[model samples]
Target: MSGKQDCKTRYPLLLAHGLGVTEHGGLYVPWGRVPDVLRAHGAEVCFGGQDAWGSIETGAAQLAEAVRKIRHLYGCERVNIIAHSKGGLEARHLISAMGYGKYVASLTMLSTPNRGSRVAELLLHARPGVAVWARGNDAWWRQGGDKHPDALRAGEQLTPAYLEIFNRTHPDACCVYYQSWGARLGKHNTDAAMRLTHGLFYPAHGDSDGLVTPQSARWGRYRGTLTGVSHQQLVDAQGVDSGGFDVRGFYVRLVQELVQMGF
Candidate 1:
């Protein structure tokens, strides 16, 4: 908490994981490797906490609290946010809705669904029972019902409501950066099944990181894309492509970019 305080020095890195999942889930995936690698490279990594099934607003509030705590503990006003999946949406909420942009230096999302997913709609309809169960257990459920007018209005369209708020609030703050990556299953394995399930629920455009597609992941300005990395592989330290590419290194690079940005 008391390391680098200079504005030019590396800033503490806050990692936000996507919805219906925990930080450990990210850690369990290939993308999770980013935190360890970033820490090895002198990044102060913190995970955003909120119920895995929580709404974007709820997750953003949690992230806002985490940011305040990070700033209080580190004595740094600005921190870099490296979010994956729903975590990206939560980070955007923190900056745009919770007013954490004042404390945010940069934001990088990994396989986030900035655009609405047809798969999500299908799941909402196809698996009403699952949706009810998820909603019941989800933190967002505590706030309001799934059919709540606000909830209905927020993510009604392709961009979703929370994402629109994020775009309006953050609107490319100084030194703010955005980038994304995607993955697909090559064979019918456990990982591939997971990707298929995610696809069924998220229904992204073209290629995806299993759940969210590269196109769905776009928000703010575009940076570029990384192909052949599955959603789970993106954070898994043990995950390796047949081509021998280090999937975790991709996230590490993203973290490094945030650190270089003074966040």
Candidate 2:
């Protein structure tokens, strides 16, 4: 009964990935094997093919187009967006600012920095040399899928000050049901790269899943955090041994929750 193909909801589901993660040629999905599992359980899943390093506005516009495609292709009225990290920001913007609330039934954000990231504040407050290095990094992102990959801009948006201001202008849509999920990777985390980040975020944010902290990700309905899942591990399987949270089972429960809620 749990993993059966009766997990269908009233609307189709769309998966949106975080920054620096692009879906090229539809060969690779951001959520790894999660999409196929959801489909097997009777969920019609789609992708929001936005640029990896695009600005929030750019991401929102791209999401609007993707939503339109989903509606037309599947003959559905609305979509339920499952966005991760920065994609959550874009998905929220689509519902709030781009008038896409009517087209969206719900938004389930997994590990999104809704309140903003602690490192983003550091980068913004750092010396001019760091800013220059960021520009060089932005150039690489620009070459990928970002027509305008301004790290400074992306950084600014992820800061507390900017998020506070952004929230005022782009409040949650009345028609859309919003909920968020967060994760944590402490100092003793398995992911080596995340362990370093965990140390950096210790003084400011305490516990984070490599990039975003638990406090920063608490937004909207505030779903609980994934105990062992890191930011990278949530989207990628990482070779053959991702030992934390069951990604496939997580989505099944999520969709099942939606189905129970009449979404």
Enumerate residue pairs that collide in model 2.
none
Tens digits of per-residue lDDT, candidate 2, 1-263, equal 34666669899998888776676522134777777778888888889988776788888888998999999998989999999888999998898888889999999998888888887788667758767977887787776666666666777788878888887888888889999989987434577777677777776766789779888888889988777677877775452335556667777898999999988
Task: Encode model 1's per-residue lDDT on 84-114: one tens digit a residue.
Answer: 7767877776776666777887787777777
- Give the least accurate 10-residue stretch of model 1, judged by summed lDDT: 145-154
The C-alpha lDDT values of all candidates are 0.60, 0.80
Q: In terms of TM-score, which candidate is strongest?
A: 2
Report the lDDT of model 2 for residue 66. Answer: 91
lDDT of 1: 0.60
State residue 8's C-alpha deviation in candidate 2, in Å.
2.1
Q: Where does model 1 exceed 4 Å of error?
A: 1-9, 25-31, 135-175, 184-190, 198-205, 237-243
User: Which 10-residue window of candidate 2 scores lowest in summed lDDT?
Assistant: 20-29
Give the CA lDDT, 0 to 100, for residue 215 in model 1: 70
